[model samples]
Target: MGIFQRLMKNKELIPLAIIMTTAVAGASSFALYAFQKTDVVIDRKRNPEPWEMVDPTQPQKLITINQQWKPVEELQKVRRATR
Candidate 1:
């Protein structure tokens, strides 16, 4: 009857057709995104200015925030300690 009817009659082909369609759509979408840029007015071939100046021997810092929650004394059970 139709092309789809022939594919349905052959059980191996239905899954392959679905996989091929999905692969083509995914690849085309990726290619389109790779070419389009929306923000800056600068030409792409020229070198753009750096957003931050390079600093050697800059001082480093570390900060930590700890939040611990403990059970209320009403929810606690007293147990005898054994050494």
Candidate 2:
């Protein structure tokens, strides 16, 4: 007999088969979404070219304090020095 005929012959298994199919489909879709690669940022400057590089001669830019920032208690200066 065909698979459909076999499935129909067993009424009790219909719900089970449906649940399993749904679970599998849901898991597969979630897996596909979770494992998909993120958008890549490509550096096209030296594609198929000779490799030549140099160390940075200057320091990186300094970060300035934001006006809206607040300091936490742990970072605050201690009022009394401990022995």
Which candidate's lDDT is highest?
Answer: 1
Residues forming the 10-long window of minimal summed lDDT in candidate 2 = 50-59
Across 13-76, the per-residue lDDT of candidate 2 in tens digits comes to: 8898899999999999977765442322134464432222211332222553433445456635
lDDT, candidate 1, equals 0.56
TM-score of 2: 0.42
RMSD of each candidate? 20.7, 16.5
lDDT of 1 at 52: 22
Per-residue lDDT for 1-83 in model 1, tens only?
88699898997998998999999999999667654523322454453532223222232223434544554564344322321
Q: After superposing candidate 1, which stretches have Cα over 4 Å from the reference?
A: 38-83
